[model samples]
Target: MAEEQEGSDAGSEEVLLTPAQLIRSLEQAWMNEKFAPELLESKSEVVECVVEQLEHMEENLKRAKGGDLKVSIHRMEVERIRYVLSSYLRCRLRKIEKFFPHVLEKEKTRAEGDPSILSPEEFAFAKEYMANTETHFRNVALKHMPPNLQKVDLLKAVTKPNLDSFVFLRVKERQENILVEPETDEQREYVIDLDEDSQHLIRYKTIAPLVASGAVQLI
Candidate 1:
């Protein structure tokens, strides 16, 4: 019985990810989803896998002794990695919310035609997680009023193409207007508002390439 109890405890032990390992895992997940979102499987799995690691890091931070320079530096490094992980996940969540809205189903088994982007194990974990926390995707992500997005969020959004979506940008270089209509004002500049930093409102596709080349920045 003692041996069996020890085995059970061992099986339940959590795996801790090193700060570097967690950053790499999160970044890889983000890049894969960024390039081929449709092909990327188990979106939440990618994020959820690091939850324990994040928690462990947080626990260490909470108890960390102060005044030691080494400890202070290490804590900042951990915090930076934590921020990266969070920003990566937030971007992915925004993509999921915009593109794959079906996975958040709290009611009814996952609907047809919406592929289980998560593996069977991951799906099971998510179902259990949501039930335990009473959380939906919106609650985790889209809830509450508008607030300042992290710097990375703005950077990622501008670089990615979201057709039919409106975005704010500052034009550093000029490109031919593809949306020009016949008899329209020739060389008419497009300005959404009076703000000098953000004067253009254009479809994402029109400016995506330019933004990728540092010709524009999302405001």
Candidate 2:
């Protein structure tokens, strides 16, 4: 019987609160409503200030409506300019294509024909080409030339035998000698007197048969 009475008492003591009572209870428990009025007023003022700035910006946008600036068709303008440029290029391209065959033929003729037949500009170009080609050909030929031979040796090695009907000898002064100079022509019989005696000088260009046959061999 006592336990039942205690349970009833506990149940009856459990307080029920309305919405206003609950809010009052929370304010008292946490002291939330006791904050300084100055802070709350400053927060409200900042919010109002932001709202006023936004309203001013909105009014400025309304006044400026499509008047404060202008926009250009930049990409379209570029494309149009490119198209105009391409029109001139198209003319040049057609001109080049139209004359391509003649140009090719002229080049071929210039390349193959005698250099003397070309115009001044064409001839100059051809000459340059010829000079370059000749240099290249010479370089290739030089690579093929015998590498170990000196210039003189190469000359001697590469020279062909000379064939001539006439034989001639040159007689020129040797230093201070006043002696008669001996020489030979293509003809057989020619003679010259030696100013110096046999002991004082050397005999040169004495023909073998002429001397043996008692022919004049001083020359």
Candidate 3:
């Protein structure tokens, strides 16, 4: 069992995760975010915890002898963790950039008290990117258009995530009676059960909720 430690966030209680557990959580988040058609909910808490763990590891490494085998192994482990963190964040940024208008629209209309899909920093980046995009459009194209045609509906123009796209996933928890919609009128919709540790390729829209709930993991 993993040990608990005091959470670093203000108003947060003890976090029930050890360093190993934190790394696993981060890796899971990274993989899910990387493959999902749409941006998933922020895993900022997990990211923060992992960063804290890495910092602690680095501080200890600073005290180790330079040529020690253990130090070299630890350094390699640190680099791998860093790569995962960087790749996870980069994937999110790419999604935000590609769908800034839609992203901002969702943020704007999010229900009060609902968890945000973006981290605070990510939210700020999305807003700034939206602003910059609009400004560039106005300067390069909108400015030359007639007043009636000057306004552009970004939500309509930008491509939204293809939620219907197929994704490969593994079930972490068993789920029964998942309704799978038919692809065509002649085909019949069916229900299926997802057993624990079972893998399948299915439409992302069909299992998006499960992914967000952590019941399933994308491969």
lDDT of each: 0.50, 0.31, 0.90
Could you give candidate 1's per-residue lDDT for residues 32-113 as a string of tens digits?
4454323234445445656656677678767878787877887787787667666665665555444332344421364554
Q: Mind sharing the TM-score for model 3?
A: 0.93
Candidate 3: which stretches are off by over 4 Å? Answer: 1-14
Q: Which 10 consecutive residues of model 3 have the lowest summed lDDT? A: 1-10
Weakest 10 consecutive residues of candidate 1 by summed lDDT? 1-10
lDDT of 3 by residue, 26-99 (tens): 89999999999998888887877777888988999999999999999999999999999999999999999998
Q: Number of clashes in model 3? A: 0
Error of 3 at 181 (Å): 0.7
Question: Which residue pairs in candidate 3 collide?
Answer: none
What lDDT is obtained when candidate 3 is compared to the true structure?
A: 0.90
Error of 1 at 35 (Å): 4.2
- Cα deviation in Å at residue 33, candidate 3? 0.7
The model with the greater lDDT, 1 or 3, is 3
